[model samples]
Target: MSDYDVIVLGGGPGGYIAAERLGHAGRKVLLVEADALGGTCLNVGCIPTKALLNAAKTYEHAKHGSNLGIHTSDISVDWTELQKWKAQTVTTLVKGVGFAEKKAGVTVVKGYGTFDGPGRVTVRFDADGASGSGPAQRAESYTGDHVILATGSVPVMPPIPGAKDNPHVVDSTGMLAVDAIPPRLAVIGGGVIGLEFASLFATLGSEVTVVEMLPEIVPFMDAELAPMLRKALGNVAFKLSCTVTAIDGGSVKYTTADGSAEAVEADVVLMAVGRRPAVQGWGAESSGLEVSGKGVAVDDRMRTNLPNVWAIGDVTGRSLLAHAAYRMGEVAAANILDPEAHRRGEVMRWGTIPWAVYSIPEAAGIGLTEAQARAKGGNVQTVTVPGAMSGRFVAENGVKAPGAAKLVYDGDTLQVLGLHVVGSYASEMVWGASVVLETELTITDLRQVVFPHPTVSELIREAAWAAKA
Candidate 1:
């Protein structure tokens, strides 16, 4: 068996980044993947979906350009062309990541790896039987001093009747690969994935309806941001506090808030409930690791109970985000090299991590929400502003709907407790506040800094000033 100093299983953002970092640190590393190099984010989940969403947005703009005093006619979307473009974009980026792996001197092994013991892995290649290179026909094993598990998650398909058999039923991956837009689309669940698809299809000229079991969409985000997103996607229908009982043919049956059952007919039904970690076939039992509802249990340094074995990314299930997984990879790598180094150092804080929902007029925030701050028994202060005040908003001169910037402050320390933005490019602006929140910058420190006029970022400064410490 080939051996190395480090072995990273699953070449997602977490795995590849850890491999690259270890290789650059002058350690012999092997990066293994079951599928493409870039994993879900690039292959299906984030990157390709964003490209499609952008295309949908462009189509919307072209269709409504006349409203903005820019006259245009005969607006049409060639979905085949759009899909082609999106695939090309994804291919370029995935190839770039492979190139980077070579440049970093990390060996890229393409196969499914399962933990055989504390410091050993058995890799089996996936099946492609045309040229006698089928999965069962080709297999390999490698041992390492350290092993990092970064296998990501898969979509959760609830046990609703006819869900698996119906051709109209689809998951997030299926939704991403649709060749053409359906006339009527029924999206099940109102979490991030559901809303994002609703926004994309609504913009792409599909009659979209989102049925959510919860009382609100994106229940995890601050309540204030939810209303803004709802208002932005006015064309989409929302059925909150509703439960899907079953699906048959192209009809979805659900119970509304009033305890009455109803059915909606649609060309497509997207099951966007959530995703779970891929831990079934990885031989967790043999490795003596514990699995819980969340995922594999690990300490702060991402080390499993077993020695020289670590887990990160969706497999660890701390946070499902790609960036969070990347950070966990770093922690796991550090702990592997020198456990004492991590043990003697400060632990990374999960909160204050920036999160964004890439729907129309994206929603993003960092730090605490106003309600969260108040719930923690702080004398909370807040300030909000409409996006119209920003020069960039004026330049676009789009219909001024409702958008706001909120700043939550601690009355005693005069420090920023939270910052939330719900408007165009809110994700981009949150980075500025993230720095402030991460560093625990006081309001007085913000005051001394000069903000360039007429930029959307200035709104953050204005919101900070309005907090009045």
Candidate 2:
């Protein structure tokens, strides 16, 4: 039996970060993880996907650079070399996480942990545990003053005939570890995962088709901007309002919106419908933790129904992004360290959370969309500015490239409610927009703020000036 100030299950972004903060604050911490230290984000999900996308983007730029007065002959993608680089990158980051945890004086246990009761967990050390800095015992029970659940999520596979046993069909994880780039790729689900892979393979000379059950892709995005994004993704076809029915060998069969049966041939098929919170198989029942279909229920302070037990990240089914998990970890750690402060301490500011899709032509949005803002029946107004307004965007991407910024705000108060962008640096620039929303910066306030000249981010300032006009 081992005892600590806190027992953290799952060393993903949320879990490891909370453990690190707690341990640094002088709390004895035991961080247990069944897989890699950096979790899916650093391993399979975010890091790997972005790495491949970045490589694809490089290949695309080299191929298309003739328009920019740069000419290169025989530009080709070396898949083997690319995979090696990706592997090296993931390895370095994972080792960095392990080093950080060790530096914070955290006891690392690489094993499967399950809750036996509140603030009590039984860890099963299988083969993965042999590599950890824990006891040699095959199984051990650890008790702590507090328990934080950050088990994260898993990919969801929908029941489609022939998809279950098909060798060509793969999930996002399988797609990431693909042995070779398929000549033809069919992606189901027009969400972030599907579109990103579609953009990647298409840029790499694959005939890519996206079949979505909805009328539009990225339903949460601004409706007017959705088509612009679709147009920006070159050489990719979209079949919206379509349902995938079966996977017949390398053919993906689906029903169109008009109930017409259609099929597309592919060398590989991606099942990117979505992911579900990993609420099962972690001994939630043993601890009697209250759970919903979404995930582990937690208040704004990241506290569960049970005393001294908290949940964050995908397990809570709140914001599942790694960055959101990072913020949630900080909030949970602050509250855990000062329990007496209660609601006065740090709490999650969900409205300020931002989301981004890393495609060739990236897209990012923060806060409510135009429709969402109007749905609230407030005095809503919106303003849009083209990326051409920025000298840097025009110089780099050219005037023909698709790029725009849209801002949603209260007409009466002029408070910025949302900001959406589709173009280069969208992912990098959305954080500033998030700060604008977080501070409730009005259009007037935003206009008064000086923006660096000749940058893509200046589009936000341009949009603010347009809103004021």
Candidate 3:
């Protein structure tokens, strides 16, 4: 039996970050992880997907450089090399996580941890970490003054007929490491995951189709910006308000919004509906942890109903994004270290959390949409600026590309309530927008902030000026 100041279960963004913070704060910490250190984001999810997408983008640029007067011949994609690069990137980042943990003086235990009691856990060592050259591994009991759960989430594999039996049907994880790019790909969801994969394959010469159940893709995105993003995703077909009925081998059958049955023939079908929190297993019930269908119930401070217990990141289902988990971990560590400040209302800010989709013409937004602001029933106003309005935007991506910035404001106060952008560097620009929203910077205040001349970010400032007009 061992005891520690803090014991963190799961090594995803949330758990690892919380452990690092606590360890750095001079608390004895134990981090238990059964898999790689960086978890899904650095392993199969965000990191690998972005690496492939970046390669696809480079390939597209090389093949279509005629517009920029940079001609190239024999441009090609080598899948083997692409996979190797992604693997190397994942390896480096995972090692980096371990190094950070070591630097923070966190003792890492490789195992599956289950709650044995309020402040206790039973860890069944991973196969590689087992001892004594025996088939039966070792299980150890440990106690902590405080425990944090950050188990993360898994992709939702909905029960559609023939989906499980069909080899062509693959979830996000499976789709990431496919044998080769299918000539025709049928994506079963139109959210960020599906749309990103669609962009990646479409750029790599796959005939792609995205079928979404909702009226629009990316349900959280601004209604006005969603269509613009869809338009920006060139050569990808989108079928909105559609429901998947079944998978017939390589074909996907679904119902259209008009009450008609339809099927898309493809060499592969990607089941990318979404992810659900991994609330089951690892002893939530035994520990009396309150968990809803959504996820482990937690307040803004990442506190659970149980004393000295906390949950963060996707496990809380507050936000599924990696960046969101990072912030949650910070808040949780702070609260744990300074219970006095935590009791004084140090809570996580749900608003001002930015989101981005890293497609070819990336899309990102922070704060409320126009409709959301209007629904709040106060004086609301919005202004739009085309991406071409910025000289830098025109110099890089021609005027023909789909690009725009929309600013939603509180009319009475002239305070910028929301900022959304669709076009190049949209992802990079949204963080600054989040800062403006976080600090409650009004349009007038934003006007005085000198933006570097000739940048895509200037488009947001332009939209701010237009709001006053």
Candidate 4:
């Protein structure tokens, strides 16, 4: 009676990963996507933004290479050529996903999918919409033993006046596809999306201004490191504890914490506020899946209240991270293929996950911060070490780039509770710290572990040693 073993309603990381796993297991799978295969991450969010950031970093490095004993002349950026390269880079990755789905023997469907009761899904093909490389699928009804709702998210465009119908206003997607860099840019939020763009544009000679409603940018990160990162990004102007009132043409008006009204005039206004799960506009209301204030309610195994229905990624609003989605997909699929997964302890939880913010000097951390540790009323010893102590950081970033690493450990148990780092290559280094936190390793245990010299990762070991003091 079922059309397939599983029906995936998205093509994002969570959806595709589930489909791939399901397909490879010899279960019939149908992956329905309305747009590109790789979702926001590959087509718009992570891949393109990182490409731009890398390009900006390269330019910034060349501009300041005199201290490193290297010099170049006539440094510039051809925006059109850069965009072309970005497009090609995205295209290649998308094709790779297509090949992956094909190799997994999954049936690819291109259309808008919505819930059609408990175990059924109705996919509606856009009458005249452009389709991705996947075969165009007509309106079809699909019933499955299990359904994965991995619809991902959409930018939270808050109701600010003139935000819509304005040429200067842009979201994260539009920000990435800018035809030309504006001289002055106003970013509304100071979260990951806002700050990342702020870092990208400021490096490329844009006068960037970040207005954050929170007391500090990257509120989810270690509080101490947040201010340090702001200071490191000296070029970009930051107005913290500010709330935007509206978006006027080419300008953003905000209210400071002190009730002072201020407006920033810019060529472009970026609404980098946040993202909400893409759960609306679908037939979910008609379905029996329980929707909560958070998002679609799902258990650790990603099962919904409705039988045979599951949700993952941003749609569930569990973590709203791509990596989290991947894990959620894994848990959801394992349960789908083998319903006894929960009995076998096959479940996903947010355990010591690594978090990263790619500013000029990137910031990444895992586990409890010092403040978080102290809040728990435990005796904690925390050490903040300069990344420059690592020979690689000194040689690569030089003395001017302020980079620091912190290790938070329990004074009683000697267990490492957290690791936070802000500097060059922080993103690349946080996962190693996550392992220490996950394993709950102690200072003595870390000391026994040898680290290669001249690498910034050595700073972790250095901090471990210092935490002893």
Candidate 5:
């Protein structure tokens, strides 16, 4: 039995990052994984999907290249080549993550790790591969002083009738791997993932129909941004306040808000409902851990009920975002190494976290919305500007597209409370607002910072200046 100071299970973004941090802090660390190191975000979820989306975007540009005075003929999408490129990109990045782990002196163990006790883990693996052929082919067990659970979440497959049996139905993972674009794709959820895929498929000539259970698509975002996104996805159809009842071979039966059942013909049904934390099959029960339907409960320090056994990332159910998981991992590693470092209690401020939906006209925001601030009983003021004012937007995507920016301020203190943007490269611009919010910068403080002319970032500064005025 090998022993280490820290043993991280599930070497995804959270676990691997924690292990690297712990190892760098002069603690002996071992990071174990059943699959790749970068987890879902790098391997299957975020990176590859974005690559595919970029390809679709390029395809769309090429298809309409003639309108832009770029004469192009016989523009075609090579599916096999696109898949190969996406796979290569994923491979390169995943290898880089593994290389970083090794450079950080983290012992990477490949297998399924089960918690044997509070600080003990037994890693089991099949003896068929390279690690199995030699003397290292057998299952192994290791004990550590501190254990971190970073097992990520998987896409949730809804329990709709006939949803599972149909071959036309595909989850986010399968949808990303699809070699051929469907002629007509029906997306079940109107959240980030669904809308992203809808944008991709619609731009690629797929008759896309997004059926959202909520009243609006991207329901978690500001309702004001929804209209802009809806206008951007003019090609795609939306059935709001709808519930999917059943999905047969090529038809989806759904109930409208009016309680009428209707079936839509679909060559492909993409399920983008959401993802649930992957907490099962890791011997969480043996550790006397309490897991709600969402995920394992953790305090601000990421500590579970059991001492020395903590959870982070999607497993904690706080925020399933990769960056959120990375932050939690850093906190967990710091708290584990030196308990007194962050004992003053840290706030999981969701407002400061930048949220992005990678639709065609991307929507992103940092800090509180106008409605959220007003609900908090603050005298809130807001300012909005059209995207056409930004020369960058006009230069890159042209002035024809519509975009807007909203800035919210505390009326009493004149502090910048929130920044919302819905337009071209809105996701990119939100990072600037994130910095302002993280620093707790007032509207006056933001106004002091000079922004270069003809840039989208200027919109953020302009919005802040307007709010202050």
Candidate 6:
């Protein structure tokens, strides 16, 4: 017999949400987290980076708000104060997680937990820290009817020389905690993470150069719109279709698309190539759980090969977004509570997911990309409209940094296939965008949904209007 109904092995968006749902549903849950309560998303990844980005955005406004008829002088960034504010923000959220777990009656064990064997786990408690609700024990074993693995991913550094073991090199986590912005920052990948950092440091008076191996940055982004974003990130230099050959102290050498070589000087190099599921130190071999190419394998209900064993979030390597993990957890938790009474509608659906990159000109997308739609052997039609077409976008952002909204639809059926938006409020439009696509709503259906006036969200309707035209 299992000691508990559910035992969550990580406290990320997936793990915590699963634990919360299980705990509230009257299931005995023990949440084991080696680090802080919120895991990487709270402690290092999303929240902290957004904090720095907000500070950078504010600094940009003060320095460049002259065109907005605002005059400001001597605007500066106090790295120390900014770091403190970021830390406080993280602490507040961590404490909230603790409170939530307590309120929901979840016993949170502060320690590194690993699979001891089937239906079992061993946790090594921290002697100096007290995240555990129960009395501390250096080593203890717990058995559960089911286990949910939500161990998050870590930044990946490429195979280039000096990418590691170099004092000047930093990953996403290290970049967040940097003492000061480098005067010359060379970002070795131009995906979301790299561009976000490039945007942050570039706006903070740093000369930022982005080097990407792909022909274009933001690889999976809408093809036409990605270049516009590259243009919007005007201050940062981009070396697309280039491979980083080596990182020799304070400089990065690269080979161009034509095989020509070039180099750029840098004070710091950020390796934001991508992230891989953290499958290490989790006792995978001993547990006998199945692991796929990159992460733990899971099914539609977020179930693994082992009976009643589930995994979610980046650990699944399915959808890396925090929101994706939350939805995955919701589905898993429902299925875990009662296998026969699983929430049918809550099954994890990949296409319904929305994505956002928090850059100066934010990018958001939902459903299939235009290419994906065409690849499905369907008659696809797409409408591309400027952000300036929206009254609020024009009024608030002016025409200086205009972004676009594009809707990809089935020309034969008139069903919306995808919606992509970029600009000032694009980051805030994903949830509503997701709802429209998730419901498989068409132009006729969308036309009936009234959008509030003078809002950037109207760009959705505007793009839809153009799609059917």
Tens digits of per-residue lDDT, candidate 4, 19-128, equal: 99989999999998988898998899988888888888888889988987898999998778878888988999999999999999999987788888677888876556
List per-prediction Cα lDDT, in the order shown.
Answer: 0.84, 0.90, 0.90, 0.87, 0.84, 0.87
- What residue runs in model 3 are displaced by over 4 Å at the alpha carbon? 130-136, 343-345
Worst 10 residues of 5 by lDDT: 128-137
Model 5 C-alpha lDDT per residue in residues 290-323, reported as the tens digit of each score = 7888899888888888879889899888888888
Clashing pairs in 1: 127-135
Model 4 steric clash pairs: none
- Candidate 5 stretches with Cα past 4 Å from truth are 129-138, 343-348
For residues 1-469, write the lDDT of model 2, one tens digit per residue.
4499999998999999999999999999999998889888999889988888899989988998999999999999878888898898899999999999999999998788888778799888755444344554588889999999999999989999999978999999899889888999999999999999999999988999999999999888898788889889868999999999889998999999999999999999999998889988779866789999999999988999999999989889988899999878888888889975456748888888999989879999999999988889989999999889999999999998899999999999999999999999999999998889878899999998888887899999999989854
State TM-scores per candidate: 0.95, 0.97, 0.97, 0.96, 0.95, 0.97
**What range of 10 consecutive residues in model 2 has the weakest lDDT sum?**
127-136
- Residue ranges of candidate 4 with Cα displaced over 4 Å: 128-138, 343-345
Per-residue lDDT tens digits for candidate 1, residues 322-347, read 87887888877777767685766534
Error of 1 at 14 (Å): 0.5
Query: After best superposition, candidate 3 residue 468: deviation in angstroms?
Result: 2.3
Stretches of candidate 1 off by over 4 Å are 126-135, 343-347, 397-399
Score residue 99 of candidate 4 by CA lDDT: 99
What does the lDDT come to for candidate 6? 0.87
